[model samples]
Target: MRFSLRSCLASLLLAAGCSAHALAPRSPGDLCGFTEGRTVLLGNLVFMMAGKTTIQDGHNEAYVKQLYWVDLNTTFNVEGAIPPNVLHSTDIPSSAPYESGGAFFAAGNTVFIYAGLMGNSRYDWMWSYNAKDGTWSRAQVDGGKLNVDHRFAGLSAVAPESNLSFFTGGWDKPITGTVVFNATDAADTKWTNVTRVEGDDAVGSPRIANGGMDYLRLGKQGVLVAFGGYDISKNGTNQTETDHDLRPMDKINVFDIDSSTWYEIEATGEIPEARSAFCTAVSAAPDDSSFQVHMYGGRSRFRENATSYDDLYILTVPSFRWIRAPTTGLIPWTEDGVGRDSHKCVSWKDGEMVVFGGTPRKDDKVQKGCSRNYPPIRVLDTSKLQWQKQFERTTKYTVPRIVSDIVGGDETGKATLKEPEGGWANSKLQSIFSQTVARRPDITEVPIPPEPTDPPKSTIPGEEPNSSNTGAIAGGVVGGVLGVAIIAGIIFFLRRRNKKKNDNSFAAATPAAPPAPPSMYPDQQQIPMDSKDDAYMQLPGELHGQTAVPPRYELDSPIQSRNRTVFELDSSARER
Candidate 1:
């Protein structure tokens, strides 16, 4: 066939355009704006809730109460073209316009958001986002004007089975007790306090903020696990002082729901360093016999001078053993630019853990950069221990003014960005970003049962439950069976050959070298006894000159001044 040069050139140009399009990095902004926000996973979508942003409000320092979602089915690819409508914001009418360090938990199709800092004060209100209908409504509870002390960075976990949500530790005061909220009973709904058992008088009980907590089902019962948060008890009663010595809670605490008791877990193996503002998610093994708490990215010490970590660790429950996940793919600081703290993470059924935005730490320096405007979304495959960049924001698009009391008012005012010249137009983008408004589903508000008046018996056993033991035993059994099968096959072959031939014709069998000692599991390797002790250890001579002296501010203070108080508050302490 005769072909014109003009046609051939056109064909080449078309192929080049297609190739470029195929190779282009998928923009996370195609789905939503870059935000350092909290995320909730429902079905195949991730709801990126309220967070601090630099783009929309002009000042670049305001917290926006905006809602965005990423269709996980589309954004799961590491290398692919930008998916349409993968990222979009919802315009649900929210009473408050600021939320940071708040508790976000989902029960059924409804997402429950508890108190978070709205402006400079902690908000005392509670709101729910119905994902099925994409509507936000204020929850009406019966407790005599619910008065929880406004606090931020507190930890919360919901027990749908018990129809209760538990809040613990915040910036206000050392919350000596776990705050229990009954959402089922609107008429009688109030915050109830669960007092913690006494610990050492000097050390006290855990009172922390910016910590991570999750509810895990152990066998038939549910347990609430708290890990890694900032404790400011040593800073005295002044809440606004920046000089307060904040430290990370190194110990792991577990609250047994059935028994209504708290106990500290002594996890062995390679426990993670003490840190706070990290994110955690629970994932059960395929067999559903045991689960793992996947923790990632938090500040190492005091928030101001803290070091960000990109490390991933898993604490196997029931066994209470820690395992440092050896991950591949993107290295946190190196590949992603810098490590992050205060990020949000959620786990899916396919063993994939998704981590959203947080503040990023600077490279080899204590000062973290404020360039987290459009932070990329990273996904970790827990089963394989590999990391992948799912989606990232590519363009700077204007979002509607996030009207909130925290920012004084509509900070964006009448200002708007000109729409990009090509692709999706401004109206199309707005349409894609329009919030879904469906009919709110009926929520059964069952009143929480009154607590027993008499002193309760202890439900905690003397020994810790070893849920992982069964899995280990099963592995050993399979290995043993395979070994036996190989040995039997060898013996049968030798016997059959001996029965059919003369023995003198055969050469002597060389003795097999003794099997090499089996390698130890990654957890079996020797690790530092204390997570903090290594911080003071001297650097080896080879690295002595390269490392800078660690920053010390309150080095001259008394040891007591360096220690924070831990509290177990009574129900009477609730804000009135």
Candidate 2:
């Protein structure tokens, strides 16, 4: 091994008490490096957990079990400004290995990742990432009595108001086992396996995997609308047996958090085709009249042919209609048609949806000239119903036109057509929505709100009239939120750098030897990437008795790996 002069100089600077961060070449805001996985957006910051990122190229990849965040405050998924920043963590991999395909949720200022594949094995444990201090720790799930083994391809969504997170419908489990956790008070947070909470039967589905779920708050009722995924082949015992069938987009389930019950409803309009291993983002009406769930890029595993998708579907609540949104813009999607799966989508502010991390389906041929080398984020303006290249700081949220036609809103997405007297759906389930949702026409909310202050501007390469060039520099652009934030953004960046230099609390994780690298690219759907991966996870019964700690891996090149493996949970050290 040889040390370059640059490395020697960096070492010397460190010895002379120079800041390692200051010596390292980085962007002005100290933007983070990008990694794909289930990412969480708390306001303007996007947090990413364990997933696969190309260390060198597409073929040379490593499984990451670390926490990374990117500042979207000053960026709108633009090319130059936003990048992943290492939030600095205690060892998170040594205790919880394997990466991605788990159920990730955010409540309060914490991010919770549950049941990701660890090594070849999996765990049913719940891991939380603290936003204040970048660190990872596991919660004592169900007071350590619940004995569900580690599983992947699951779905999770958090209701921040209630401080509750729920997980359900992964592999093997046919939509059973709904684990709920309340992190309102992190120090003594509680986890409840809704399946075993009482003797009652939990919500059931056809062994769904890689589905899309997002929360919509209506008054006191917080509902998670989950739909579309692979329906694994199951037996009488509800155990996943063989391959799978793509679940129909029409087969939707609405989990009402307040009632702890699920309502099965079919949506109308131009419905989307059946698909799975997809992601979802939700933008709701301020008055809770409706929620537009933007479902994007997913794949379907049929018999022989594995197909990928790049279309957008908006599912509107109350009206319960599925509007197959158009993808006619110059850049309709980020990855072309290369089968987006296991990715994550979060609503940015009230206007756009930001997508991150996802591996293309194995059979889908590689993209034309593009890869993850560029920005790994995709922004979609759900209201405008168009894909965009960059985010604009809009003063308000807009409802999509077709959605407003049914649900009715006062804003830009306001209904163009008058809603019928009885509303969209029939009487069968009308009570559910009527009781929970604010109806149109007579509904006290705004009838037709004002349009955006300016004609909404985007930066797509070949976008039409209102669009501008993607090459437009971030600093030069004015109006909306950034209209006069040059000095403020600058001040924020300086304060961030200053804090990093003075803060000694983040000095805990310094490793002597790097961990090993994970070579296999595990599918979130848990399809046998290889026979070894399949066999290693085939051990029958639930993991009982003592908790099994997963073996951690490092990058094949330690230079890129997160050296630390253990992180102290903010609350307790007991790993239950």
Candidate 3:
């Protein structure tokens, strides 16, 4: 098996417990402003509260039980009890099955809580709480018609520059649209249904069980994004693949408010495996480039004692990658505490995503709430990706087992609960457990770069020339013609020259022929006489450079005479 370089490195990191999910301790510098396992700091004091969710509306702190105003910049001593006044009676919507309700926003001093689901019934009324006057007023649904019967599955609100509130996502029933309401001007309450995505693949299916969460403004450059929720059919019992379709959606459907269209982005990497009824929070660093969306503990696999994970993940925008966050060495809960689900998550200052107020494990036989429960307030820092236990210092509250419609804190500049500006109440926050009136801090917003509409240009190398290139036909023909002509000229010259120097010259250079042939018979042949009789002698230079020659044999000797006589006798016999 060939392992990639990346896989090897990942394995090494995991082995060393240096990975994001591990409980290894981080360095001191990594802790920055907050320490590991520290309480959540609101303005100056740290809160340890459970069972109740909180948000800021201006100078007023709104919870399920009461509404109060506090100077967020100062510390509240037990002696100096801040004035607490009840907003909703314990019996009014009395233990409304809908634990999730209340939407908080500061519009020129007025904080409004619109129709949140009261138990199973969808509340048609809007309740307005004024921070400046410290009073509550009921808001009218301008169209004279509101869906009171069908509880909204998910609701999102954004305060555009116009100070108008736009809510979208039809929940509970199959309402495929959005509504725009102007709380500042009562008459401007108008519900305009936006277009829904067309298909059996619509994300709006199995609406009842799944809750909604997202950013209000949908555009390419929009800072907000929406994600996971519970789906009854999909996450519910007797769920066939087709019967339940919403528990874990692979596609993160985004609504481009600017284009008024829906875009589905596919998620990849070591992302949290498919699960629903989870929570998300954002952490914006001093340098905006470090901004991230963090997903924390959730129920992925349902069981009788199915533990909610303490795993933390951060989605880095712009690059669009999910990175495991570094942890500050803290455990999720004591070994004895029970695992949790259906919780509220919010971000605190110093780069922490504080999750608080969730319900207990649901039993199949008894479906209302779980018997074994957990601490109400648990703060998780995405930067650290660990849970800090400060339940002792915060409010002591138990599980409120329902989705909170409004979860935002005061962001206004004032000191009164007048502006729950930053914390859980930022416009970007989906629904949470409660609402309040403290100044909310400004969450660092990330602006997405515009998508490129044009296609990328090719970067491949083009064809080039080397030594072999030439005009093939012309070059070959020209070379062949020149070669033939040169050969012909040489051949013709050689033939002419050879004819001029022919055989006539050969005869002149020949020696004279012998005068006559010798006669064949010995009697007819003339024999030369001895030198004394003929008187023939050698002349000077007659034979060039010749010396006097001696006769080859002696005239008479025993062996020679005998050999010659025998040879003569043999010749005479042959002749006869």
Candidate 4:
């Protein structure tokens, strides 16, 4: 038994009152924002809620439900709110954030979170937040009647104007039914299941997990643009996550919002190293003529080691080309290069991507040269194609040079790339991507109303988000008086894995629906430890950077595993 600081830290996560899912709390400021959480855009303000984070230390790191918001403009800062009645895990508090995949949509003044796994722990599996009062409460899904079974790591799209959101696919086989939630009448909002036959993998062809997708307005039709994820069937015979397929980002999957069909589109460019469990954010040219998706840090596990990436890539629509965006603000944590994964990305104020909490791979390497380290919360300004150390905090958005070059830029922005070489040749595909909306000065119309879909469920309709009365806004790391002070003494122990032999069995979490019998937590499979008496749970990931190929399988560390999270170690082998 290699019991030392490494395992000791892992043991601390379940420190009596903290609950089994709690990871060790790193000293403050080691990282920023939330990782593996859900994000929604409501106006210029982007709200980042849940996942894993190290806040002001008053609440449990695992169960404390903390909500953080970025104003996008006016200030380079992030403020948070402890929504009343935040959830916790088993024998823990109630109402914790979805561990990984949950449908988070923002419509009207409310943010609706309809989660299947962890949410099962609460009577109200679907929770809603009123941005108006900075309060969190329960929302209904057709009188709490969820027609479809519990699903996680699925695909989703939200249409604000129509007050409808679509979700399909689950962690197991690709789900045929499309789950529709109409928020037209908030109180009476209902869930409609557009059922499909199983075995028709093409039903939501490539409905893989841990990938990225966003709603787009091509021509005049609304489409869901998706990229990168892994299929369970792809897991090799080894049965161990030690090896698996890392989906390529260059390949694009298109889901037509109106038609309920899936299309595969071709792209030409340098293929980014295949990966899964990564984070993504998309922005469109002001005209809706072209769209660009920024793929940020994610992991790739093979052999005995786990690898996460720190670079960024841009996938543009129509031309359908892959362009690696320049990334250099945050310090490179390992030889693999600032490896990060299981984080969230939000397209912010005029074409910038704001990233929140990401755990870099734990490797002891100086990266060869001198570099400045930025906080866990990062921002990328596409207009200039460079990473910004802080938020731009301005309302105006300049078209990305890459987008303008392919679609056609303005006066000084000369278009250089030739027309796309036969990517959208199919009629059905052409009709979709070529679809366009008329923009007349008299009527403020966008190619795709940047409001609901493209800019996404993020743009709230009124008032600059005032956090003064909300949670404390950290400075520098995020911004504010307690910013540097809050995280001064903490170190992080970010991830954990089971050491039990033959732990190779893929433990799938059995998720239940609400009417409550447990605490809030998504589906996580359970497994046995080496010592029968000292059992710990196995999730879909690895320790020390979450390098597991599968979704970080939900691991409710009943023992030592939960302790290996959040803190960075100065010495000792970060036990696998």
In order, the Cα lDDT scores of the candidates are: 0.47, 0.50, 0.33, 0.48
Q: What lDDT tens digits, residue by residue, belong to model 2 across residues 1-576?
A: 123433443343334332222222223221212333556565345666656544211213345444555544333344322322212223354565435455566665566766554534434456666554454577654454332434556677766556677777766452365667776666666776654332133345335566777777643456777887756544322211224555678777766566566656666677787766567888876555566788887765444555667778888765667887775543533444445555678886557787675544323542311132233466777667666756553424677666666655566544433222345343434444554433212111111112235422222221112125323422222232242234334444555676766332211222222222111222333312211111111111111111123323212112322223121100001112
What lDDT tens digits, residue by residue, belong to model 3 across residues 439-474? 233322222122235422211111212225345534
Clash count per candidate: 13, 15, 63, 45
When sorted by TM-score, best at the front, the candidate numbers are: 2, 4, 1, 3
Task: Point to the candidate with the largest lDDT.
Answer: 2
Off by over 4 Å in 3: 1-108, 117-125, 141-144, 147-171, 182-191, 196-212, 216-224, 230-243, 285-287, 301-307, 336-338, 360-373, 386-576
Model 2 stretches with alpha carbons more than 4 Å out: 1-36, 55-59, 80-93, 119-126, 136-138, 147-149, 196-206, 233-242, 328-339, 360-363, 366-375, 393-395, 406-431, 435-576
What is candidate 1's lDDT per residue for 1-576, written digit by digit as tens?
113433443444444444433332322222212333556664445666556433311223234446666554332333221222334455534464344545565454555666554434433356766554456777655433333434556677766554567877766753457777765543344566677564331123357666778877642346787876656546533331233434434366766565465665455557687766678887654433345688887755433353557788876555455667767875544544356665777765536777765555454232221222223456776655667655321111121122111112222222222111232222322232121112122222222222235422211101222456656645655665455445444544665665775342111232222332221111222322211111111110111011012321111111211223232111101111
Per-residue alpha-carbon lDDT of candidate 4 for residues 35-132, written as tens digits (9 for 90 to 100)? 55566665434665545543322222232234445443233322121111121111111453434446677665666765544423423246676554
Higher TM-score: candidate 1 or 2? 2
What is candidate 1's CA lDDT for residue 72? 47
